[model samples]
Target: MTNFTLSDLESIVATRAAASRDESYTARLKEKGVAHVAKKLGEESVETIIALVSEDEERVISESADMLYHLLVALHLKNIPVASVLTELARRTSMTGLAEKASRTPQASGGRQED
Candidate 1:
């Protein structure tokens, strides 16, 4: 039970996303479907990048939170449970990073990485 696993974040986001239209911003965004959620994620990601490059620690933390929240929203709209994703991650953990990289055959990890 890690305090801040990605699964925990997913649960929080999914719960908030299910709220009524006026209940929470997450709910409102969820109501707009995956496209809107993805748009928000993109915006937050840019904010995080800015924070990483030129902002203070607090700003980086804040923007990272925002990015994570929007990402969860997107994932929720797609009906993907955190547990399902974690299962995949757990599987990946069994392999070495380099081995995992090489194991993802040509067509899988983005078309062979252009040699």
Candidate 2:
């Protein structure tokens, strides 16, 4: 069995983003801009949620894969490296969830208000 990591998937998606649009769905999505890519990610998220609600483990796995792919595409569109996300996750791991949430300085735009 081969081990597949998010880094591996990110690299593959990056290559696809560079491929001819006619030859790569990833490239086509990138050409459509961030709004389109975000919409695709949202759709995949709904599908994954539906699959989970229906208790279909296989479908959940499939939709989760689609969601992750769309997420990676969105990240690439914004030039945000996967390592940055991982670093944030690692940092969060150092604190309890509630403590982490409490520590965050909410943005003025629809973010949590100061206590």
Candidate 3:
């Protein structure tokens, strides 16, 4: 089996984003703006949930790939590197899930949340 990392996928997505929109779906999605990318991500999320609820492992895997791709596209559109997300995940892993959840301070207005 090939070893594929998220960084590898991110690189591919970045390349596609720079490609001609007519030739690249990723480029087209990027041209459509973040709202479009976010809508695709939401659609993929629902499809993935449906696959999981139906107990279809293969479908779940397929839909998950779609979901992750859309998520990566969304991140790209916002100029957010996947490493930042991985760092957050890594940070959360240091604590129990409940503890992590409790640690998050809700956002006030449009400002950043305080821990």
Best by TM-score: 2
Show pairs that collide, candidate 1.
none
Model 2, residue 71: distance off in Å is 0.3
TM-score of 2: 0.91
State the lDDT of candidate 2 residue by residue for 1-115, as single tens digits.
6799899999999999999999999999999999999999999999999999985788999999999999999999999999999999999889998787777766622584544
Please give each candidate's TM-score.
Answer: 0.81, 0.91, 0.90
For each candidate, the alpha-carbon lDDT, in order, equals 0.83, 0.92, 0.92
lDDT of 2: 0.92
Q: Model 2: which ten-residue window has the lowest total lDDT?
A: 106-115
Give the total clashing residue pairs for model 3: 0
- In candidate 2, stretches whose alpha carbon ends up further than 4 angstroms from where it belongs are 108-115
CA lDDT for candidate 1: 0.83
RMSD of each: 2.7, 2.6, 3.5
What are the runs in model 3 whose C-alpha is more than 4 Å off?
108-115
